[model samples]
Target: MFVGIIVDIISAINMFTGQVIPARRWMEPFLLHNQSILGSVFYVITYGGRCIQGATATILSFCRVCAVCFPIFYQKLGQPKYIYTMQVLQLFGGGVALVLLWKDEYEYILEDNGLYSVGSDETNADWFYMFVAIMEVFFVVVIVLNNLVTYTMFRLKFNKKNAMKNNGVSPISSQTNQEKQKRESGLDKMTFIVCLVELIYFAYIVYSLQINPYMNKRIFYFFYNILCVIYSTFSAWMLLIVSKPINTELKRMFLIIGGKRLTRSISISVQGSRDNHK
Candidate 1:
């Protein structure tokens, strides 16, 4: 996810700079000769990022299900090092496959109106769309199924715990059960949020594709590009928001920074007042 963000930042910089800066004599030859390659690289980066996001969300949902349904097994699976290793491998493999498959789908074309744009070959474009549809379906199915399983397991556990309490179970065991329930509930909510964001983003992609044939206006094209960028960026933000630990840490960091600044300001004000009085 961090790597995806860095790639996106670089791509955005290259995109805007490439447009605003006039083509130089030395650069024109390279651009003209390698436009297709450049287009392929961009296409891979864009869709590769989406693949990583989808995979991350799916993995998270699965982990939530495991944690709720099979606590004992999840103890080993949920270790930070193991999870991080899996994430790294998943992203690396998915990125390579996407680049190999979709890189050739994009081609650079110079229109008669003197505008240069990246155009997709009709056959390859259809394949790309099909690939995206498959990914969306896979992600949604995995997330929904995992969420259902997690919820079912949580309910069973909750009821069992309650029955134990009624049977005069120790207070410590009841407290531990309650804590476990709370943690599982948080994971469930986080999974739901991630799934919701994925669905919304998928819907937007479908809507845009349907309206694309009728969008001949340049202003609409500009807005479409902006929307693509926003959607790509929003995925990372959604992950951060859905993560309880990360959100808590971010809030704590912001509070500490603000408190420090306030204290410094107050101390400076007091020092200035004393100096003036002296």
Candidate 2:
């Protein structure tokens, strides 16, 4: 959720900029205009978020797959040492990308879709497109493979249950197993929704910036902007929808807060009424 919030905030900046660019309702915000600090900052944030979020999702799926298919290494990966190492790596790598991208001021020329590194070399335009393409393709391949394997495992479990029933044997499920299954099911749904939304974002980026570069720029840019806003939000909302625990917690929290406020207001009103009467 932390990562999601930060990514959404940065993406919102670009979305806001994109909105202004078209309607010309007001002048461009100084921070986000072309070749400005915000322009480069947005690039690093978006690109880093894009790559890191996808990688994070993949790592989670990979961990689940390890739990199912490779229990030996799963334990190792879940260890505090290993987990901490991975977290450090993500931060370190993201920092590295920040440095590489911001080598000089003009390295990242923030245009409509936020993918051009137009600094000192014209040929690098195509390079940025290719880089984005390559990163997205890597994520897509890993995500699809992990999902397919998970689906296959689920089917096998279903078949085995059917076979046991047919053979006049009852398959026992422990409370622990049931709980784990429920959690996994929620996670599967959440990951699937997030991945689907992200894929749509990636596909449009590739198409507009790479595949069909000559398309109507303004219209495409506007649509991309809309997508940025959508991608920023869809994950967190989907989590609340798919995960009963989180949804319930949020509801309970809000209800408690509202009830307290209402009770306080009622007490204040009653005191005022008593004072007037006296």
Candidate 3:
């Protein structure tokens, strides 16, 4: 997630600087024009980072599904070192893409009706996009499978947990177990949303890029926002929403502050009333 966020940030910079700012011509200090150093860098980060994020997201969804369907094996394979190694390999894959495109010419090439696109020259462009598209589609497929597995496991566990409760198990154990199950269910639901959103967003992105490769600059920039910043923003908020611990902590903090202010107000009111009475 952290890596995704960083990639999104760089992509946003590329989008606005390379495309949006130039289109609007609003206080344009610099332009990421064709065959420029900055343009090359933007292409590298935008494409390469996309590959990185796509691959990692698929891995993440797989991990979650594994946790649900094969908890024992998931635990065995879920060590920090192992996960880190996998992440590094994913980065390496992206790095390869980056290296390939590092020297490739980037251009705000002209589109139909005098519009410009934030992309590379014809050379290596076709296969590069195909590579990114493949990873994105692979991620969608994997996440869909993961979603099915997670939903099945969640439903089964939910039914079993409810049955135990209805059977009048020990009150304390039942409550404790129920709470645990609730947390698990919440996580599963979160995973469901994550997978569903991934399916939707990636499908939209891929479809849009394919069907309409040439468009007005503003429209393209809007799509860029959807591709990176907006998606990341949604993920962040959804994470906060699904995180019980974070929600609880935030609620506690708010309560503490509210209580203090209420108590102080009451004390002030009481003192004023007494003074008026006396």
**Best-matching candidate per lDDT:** 3
Q: lDDT of each model, Cα atoms only?
A: 0.63, 0.65, 0.69
Q: Please list all clashing residue pairs in model 1, or write none if there are none.
A: none
Model 2 clash pairs are none
For residues 146-234, could you state the per-residue lDDT of candidate 2 as single tens digits? 87788678657656755655676533544444555676678778767766876787788789877797676457756866777777777
The CA lDDT at 145 in model 1 is: 88
Off by over 4 Å in 1: 1-38, 78-85, 92-98, 101-116, 169-183, 200-255
| Residue 30 of model 3, lDDT score | 49
Could you tell me how far off, in angstroms, the CA of residue 144 lies in candidate 1 after the best superposition?
1.7
Best by TM-score: 3
Model 1 clashing-pair count: 0
Worst 10 residues of 1 by lDDT: 17-26
Residue 72's lDDT in candidate 2: 94
Candidate with more favorable, higher lDDT: 1 or 2: 2
Q: TM-score each candidate.
A: 0.65, 0.74, 0.78
Error of 1 at 73 (Å): 3.3
**True lDDT of residue 13, candidate 3:** 76
